[model samples]
Target: MKIFLAQQNYHIGNFESNTEKICCAIDLAKKDGADLIVFSELSVCGYPPRDFLEFNDFINKCNEAIDIIRKHADTIGVIVGAPDRNTVKEGKDLFNAAYFLYNKEIKGIAHKTCLPTYDVFDEYRYFEPAYHWNVIEFKGKKLAITICEDIWNLGDNPLYRICPMDKLMEQQPDLMINISASPFDYTHEQDRKAIIKANVVKYKLPMFYCNGVGSQTEIVFDGASLVFDKNANLCGQLPMFQSKLEGFVLNDDGSIDGPIITQAKDVPDTDLNPIGLDEHLNIADIHDALVMGIKDYFGKMGFSKAILGSSGGIDSAVTLALACTALGSENVRAILMPSQYSTGHSVSDAEQLSKNLNNPYDIVPIKNIYDSFLSELKPIFKDLPFSLAEENIQSRSRGNLLMAIANKFGYILLNTSNKSELATGYGTLYGDMAGGIGVLGDCYKMQVYALAAYINRDKEIIPTNIITKAPSAELRPGQKDADSLPDYAILDKILYQYIERRQGPNEIKAQGFDAALVDRVLKMVNLNEYKRNQFCPIIRVSPKAFGVGRRVPIVGKYLS
Candidate 1:
């Protein structure tokens, strides 16, 4: 039988668009002479609908979309994910379900068994776990179908007590299909491959996996779907960050029949070495993910133009370049607000960088604005020295000008604060942190430099001076970031341990970090939860980002 994987981008709660996209794919699969087509988890209403599932009207829209898709399945079998209402008086109101449609009717349904409640997921809040298991008998073969998190419960030390595949294998199915809406992280691609291979090896059956592509607000789905044969060979793999439809002929022996066919090119159907898919996480993937995140964040939100403060630093330069690429040079605008302490090259470098990208920009000198603020506050600050109060005025002045431009014209200010400064609370709130979206908030300062180098890999998109210059906020004369915080090389390691790894003060100090310095940095991160809580939504590319995934109480005193 022929199987087609519909790895497509989906919009959440957009029943009209989602129905149209799925029907188009179904038609394409029928024309390709395929017997079956598979879509990602919740392809009807999009994944992680969050609080939308609480509304019965929203679930009605999902059922309507499924009905639209079900009509087209008369010629070819369609497997798609949607939320189904539970008729029982007990348990949750809904079950994360997958519907199999063929011959203008519902053939089978598989409910997601494992509801992940950890970071970035609250599925248990909405979905009732599946207590029943069954296999669908299609033309000449039995099919074991599962949702996103169902098959994830298989491993040496599984998260769930029961493995759905183990129970399904008892039915002696000829093929296994997994519909997923897995989100993307830099290191997750390899993990995805490993899981698929492990399941195929464990069940000794070929698997067809399909995942959703495109960004859903802060979360991005990289649609690198796969087909693994019974021997654990990767017969077919889809592209990342885009929509793709590919067909495969599965033999009765639980192996793909021919060479893997993709929209771009064909992959040789040779014995797949397990190590072939183990690609190390690199900066290039991170760059592409960020660009996709920015593009989708704007496109999905109905934004056309973007504006940001171009400080001529590595973070701003990289953010500007990526935004230009995603939103077009004509659509992106820069506001260069230089202060009294701004170096001559800072303005010149920003101008030169704008020239390189061919993006429009305006120089709004904040010196006058800074003087106005200080002049008014001079009476109350008579005894205060030239300290953080004076320094913050320059930043806030720049912020005001950027916001005014964003408001007058239709533009969303892009924040350029890197993770290091954000972790330490070194940035002034409502100053550099003022933006509709934070571009590099999840990226570390050193990763910002790496992204700059990647942007200039083929041509000099970011000026060399900006990359080579010493980083600074330029709030005061001879100001440098190192004077306040530790070197980024040293600081990022501690942050990765504390924030990403969840290491405590003493545990981090065990990793060769100074006990005193570790406590100081960790305290700063803990004390600044209020600032982060107010910060705009960040584009997440790392394992742990500052947004909904990493939640900390703003007023609670943990380490502070």
Candidate 2:
């Protein structure tokens, strides 16, 4: 039997567009003479429809789309994911399910058994785990179908108590087909491949996995779908960050009719230590993910132009470069809002960087704006030393000017704050932290430097001076980030331990970080939850991003 895997980009709640894309893939697969075509999880209505799942109209539209898709299944078998109503009425209203349609009929339905609840996943809130399991017979072969997280229950210390594949194995299935909507993290690609291969090894069956692609707000689904032969050898893999449909032939002897791409390899035992400052990060993949994130966020939102403050710092430089790459250079506008403290070289560096990218830019000095604010606030302040208030005034002045220009030009403000600054409350609310979408809120300072280097890999797109210069807010004279925060090399590691690894102060200090500094950093993170809460949606590239993925109470005084 020839099976095709359709890796697609879906827009949440855009039922008409999503259904049309799915049906188009089905038609293309039929043209290729595919016996069955599999789509990623939640393809009908899109993944993590979140509260949309609660609305009866949303589910009805999903069913309506399914009805249309089933008509196409008259000539070829189709397996697609969508939310199914729960008639039992004992549990949740819906079940995340995969429907098998053949000969214009509902052949079988496989409800997802594992609904991931941790970090970035709130599936349990909407979906009820499958209470029963069964294999669907198709073309003289039994197919074991599981949703994204179902096959993830393999290793030690599995999250779910019941394994769906284990129950489906009872029917002695001949092939395993799992649909997924896994998001992109630098470490997840290898981890996903290992998990799928492990499942194929355990079940002793050929497996076809199709994953969703494109960015949904902050989460980026990278569709590097895979196919593993019964012997656990990787037969093929769809491209990452792309929408594709590829076919393969499954012979009766349980071997995929293709050259072995990779022999079955042992899953790496080494853990990706989030606490350590590793330089071997997959920067290329992160680059692609961020670009896709920007493109989709703009494209889906019907936004064409982007505006950002190019401070000549590494963060803004990288953000500008990425925006230029994603949305055309002409569409990204850079505003150089230089204050009194802003160095001359900083302005020149920003100008040169924009020139290199050929993006339009303007020089808007904030010194006059800063003086005006102080003049207005002098009656209230009387005689106080110039402090954080004055410093933030400069930052806020820049933010206001940028916003004003963005409003006038109909441009979305792309935030350039990095994760390290956001983690420790170094950013000012409604000032440097203001944006329509964050471009680097999930990346550490060191990662931002890495991205700068990656962007300059082909040529000097971002000026070397910008990449090598000392980091600063330029709000205060002679101020460096190190004045308020610890060295980023040290601070980022501690923040990673606390934020990503979930390591407490004691645990982080145990890893050789200074105990006092660890406590201080953790306190800043906890105290600044309010600041991050108000921030825009950050393009998530890490495993634990600060948006919906990492939830923390603003008033929680764990370390404060």
Candidate 3:
């Protein structure tokens, strides 16, 4: 049996263009003399339809696409992951399913058994799980087919068993096929490969994984398809971040002939094995994912040029590095604004970093602007305390400067604030938050440091001082991030369990840490909802991002 893999890109809701891509892959697979070609999950309708799922017309259009695809049923056998209406009551109204079409017939349709509800996914809110147990007989072999999350039963919590890979194994299938739209998560591929290899070793069956590739908002799906023999050795690999079709031939004697997506990247440890990759840890993979993510996001969204504030800080430096890589150095521009409190080193660093990136930059000092505002407001405030207003004034000035540049040049402002600061209300709303899109909003403070290091893996681009120095907004004199919050190593750990895992103070404290610090951090997180809410577009990488996933009332009381 010859299996074909179509690792391709798709637009979120452009059904016509996306359908054409799928049909082209089908034709290519037939040209290669393959038995059946499998596409990434939801290839027909795109991986995440988001709010489009609510529209009845959206579902109807998806159905219409399936009908359009059925025209080629006689030409070749095709496996397509698509969304369908749920017939059963008392559950979700839609089903995430796959259809096996061949010989002018819809042979077998397998509904996804597992629906992920965490992080960027809320499948339970839109999709119902397939309750039926099925194993299709194809080419004298029984085959079990599943979707992305169907095989992702491994998690921090192991008590709950969701996937029925074990159940499918009972039917004695010679091969298992899993189609996934799993997004990139620093070290997710290693965990994924291990599970697939384990299944191959345990079941004594050949396993195939076909995943999607593309960038939607901040989520990137790298289609690194794999085929593992019964001995658990990888037999085939596909392109990681682009569209390509590959074929593998399995003879009756079990001799496999093919090429896998080459294990070509110089970054170490991409093989499917167990490894931990949290924020600031998996820099190489994160760099690649972000580069692909930024490039595709700009290309797909119809934007060409980007404008960003050059704050001489590590966050802005890292964001600029990625932006330069994504949008060409010519298309990305940096603006430097020095306020009354702005240090000379900051302005100098901004110039040096832009020089390192080889991108053009403009300077617009905010001294006149800051002095003008203070001169006018000094009398009104009288002897009142100059609280956050003074700090925020500096930020708003910079935001205004960047926004003005964006407006004048018709460039989109790329926000550079990280998740740690955004999570703690350390950012000033409409100051740094005023932007068209956020590049590293989903990444944490510690993660930004890692990305900077990764960019300098070959040679130094970000200044060493930027990496080694303590973080600060520089609105106040000699203020370090530690003056307001804990160290990032401790801070990120607490935030991971709190935001992504949704553990409260009691839950986090139970995990063994300083209860006093936990209370303080929780208070800060809860109090800062308004600032995050007012933020611009936040590109999400983690499961729980600020925009929609972590919603808290701006006027809510203290939880503790």
Which is the leading candidate under TM-score?
2
lDDT of 2 by residue, 101-206 (tens): 9999998999999999999899999988999899999989999999999999988899999999999999999999999999999889888878887888788999
Worst 10 residues of 1 by lDDT: 270-279
lDDT tens digits by residue: candidate 3, 1-560 = 88888888898888998889888888877887878888889989897887788899998888788777777656677888888788778588888989888876778889887787766777878888888868888778677898887776644554235557777877877788898898876656676677776566567777788999988876788888888765566778776777778888765544466553333222222243222226555567677777888888888889899989897899999999999998999899999887767778888988999998899999998888877888899999777876778888888988888888888888988989898898888888888887777788888887888788789989989988778777888877877889989998999888888877777789889888799999988888888888888887676565567885566788888663
What is the TM-score of each predicted model, taking all chains together? 0.95, 0.98, 0.89
RMSD per candidate (Å) reads 3.7, 1.2, 3.8
User: Which digits, one per residue and each the tens of the lDDT, describe model 1 over residues 1-560?
Assistant: 99999998888888899889999999999998999999999999988799999999999988888888889999889999999998884799999998999998998899888899877999999989888889998897899999878877865678988778888888999889999999987767777777777777778888899999998778889999999888777789899998999999998777787764432112232223232112224678888888888998899899989999998888999999999999999999998988889999999999999999999999988888788888898889887779998898888888888899999998999999988888889898988889988889988888888888889999988988898878898888898988899888778888888887787898888878899989889999999988998999888877788989998898887889
On a 0 to 1 TM-score scale, where does candidate 2 land against the true structure?
Answer: 0.98
Model 3, global lDDT: 0.80
Indicate whether candidate 2 or candidate 3 has the larger TM-score.
Answer: 2
- The alpha-carbon deviation from the true structure for residue 15 of candidate 3, after best TM-score superposition, in angstroms, is 1.3
Give me candidate 3's TM-score against the actual structure.
Answer: 0.89
Q: Which one is best on lDDT? A: 2
TM-score of model number 1: 0.95
